[model samples]
Target: MGSLDLEVTVYSRHSSNYHSYKGNIGTVNDNILNQKFNAKEPYTVIHTDIAQVKLSNGQWGYVSAVIDEANQEIIGTVVSS
Candidate 1:
């Protein structure tokens, strides 16, 4: 009879600094919703982000998107050059 052996390996990864913002001006309202999301409420958190993009005429522009955290859906979007 022959003996068989098997081994298993696992890998785990995590990041503590996943999101960040810099160069913010004074008097920034960091908690506009009164920490509503911490209460486990729906439609209480909204997130917005801006991205630099290229236009159709080869020009640089900006695009911003506002999303609802509860459903992860975009509520508003804007583009400008």
Candidate 2:
């Protein structure tokens, strides 16, 4: 292969170091919900989450939302670039 001027493609694998700085930055709270998802009132139980999304311009953005457990509706939302 060397004499014929041909070379094989080599691939490499890498480990993720995204959480390298995870060193007691915040306190872990107790599981108050304990798998209970039902809520009698609108504001009694709420859930929040942040998600990363790919935009149309090939950029990354974050979407944060708060949901009401009783009606399963999104009470608040925010988008950040």
Q: State which candidate has the highest lDDT.
A: 2
Instruction: Give Cα distance to truth, residue 59, candidate 2, Å.
Output: 1.6
- List, in order, the clash count of every candidate structure: 0, 0
lDDT by residue for model 2 (20-57), tens:
46678888899898989899888989999988665677
Please list the residue runs of candidate 2 whose C-alpha ends up more than 4 Å from where it truly belongs after superposition. Answer: 1-24
lDDT of 1 by residue, 1-81 (tens): 135564322232222443546567568667666765542455677779998655567555889998878777789999889
Report the poorest 10 consecutive residues by lDDT, candidate 1: 7-16
- Candidate 2 weakest ten by summed lDDT: 9-18
Clashing pairs in 1: none
